[model samples]
Target: MTVEVGSPAPDFTLKNQDGQEISLGDFKGQKAVLLVFYPFAFSGICTGELCSVRDDLSSFQNDDVQVLAISCDPVESIRAWARQEGYEFPLLSDFWPHGAVGESYGVFSSDLGFSFRGTFLIDKDGIVQFLERNGPGDARDQQGWRDALQDLAA
Candidate 1:
């Protein structure tokens, strides 16, 4: 089942593009997390979506919220992708156990061996405050996420 609002998000410790351990709990108390699960790095839609975040960073980067983009790609690929795309946020590698974290949140697309467009807004308390899932190739409605974050920050 997909994660829902008010439900506690599953905690995970994934490696960032730099191969450093980064856990969902790492940002506790300081910032809520915007967990973005994409299909892959360097994909057309994925790049566009992430670039949008990079272009308007103030919407995501602040004291109240931290944005993290995750994919099943290896750390090396993620590192290169981040450099090419100029993604300032952490590009986490859900690689090793192969989409295990994505599976935990019910976002794994087993057929494609990747994640669909699943976005979860996890509050400081570790509960999901907003969640959205779109079909393959479907871009997200980012306004919804921004609105939710605005309410949370208020």
Candidate 2:
């Protein structure tokens, strides 16, 4: 039930690791956003996935594109995790509303009480350029994201 490509992305305001509010609309007409919704922080798969992004961020580091990682963890936990993981990108907290943003993207899992692996590439126009979701316990194919970004940057 992820967002369809070419459709308008749903806007939302959520707190980042520093507790500062970040709204999806803030990037409109500025940069394309890579909105990543994961299940938790400090977990093995989650750690590895984010680390990959951290280690090779130049691929998505241009002024025209920004990466935002969102999780159901609280701001405090996300802050600590970001520090520990050396994630220079914004890690948003979807905790207060308990996955409200994830729910809007159709990635929230009520039973697991967290968001699944929903990854979206939103263009500067606030349109969804790419949308895909992996089931719980399934590792995402990072190359797929890179390929999409390549297509967008073309």
Best by lDDT: 2
Quality of model 1 by C-alpha lDDT = 0.90
Q: Write the per-residue lDDT of candidate 2 for residues 27-134, one digit (tens) a residue.
A: 999999999899999998999999999999988657989999999999999999999999999999999689889998999987889999999999999999998999
Against the true structure, candidate 2 reaches a TM-score of 0.97
Compared with the true structure, what per-residue lDDT tens digits does model 1 show for residues 1-154? 6578889999999999888999999988778999999988989999999999999989987878899999999999999999998888999998879999999888897788998889999999899999998876999978998998998888
lDDT of 1 at 54: 94
Q: Using Cα atoms with residue i matched to residue i, what is each candidate's TM-score against the true structure?
A: 0.97, 0.97
For residue 115, model 1's alpha carbon misses the true position, in angstroms, by 0.5
Runs in model 1 lying further than 4 Å from the true structure: none
Instruction: Give the clash count for each candidate.
Output: 0, 0
Task: Give lDDT per model, in order.
Answer: 0.90, 0.92
Q: What are the C-alpha RMSDs, in order, of all predicted structures?
A: 0.9, 1.1
Q: Residue 36 in candidate 1 has what lDDT?
A: 93
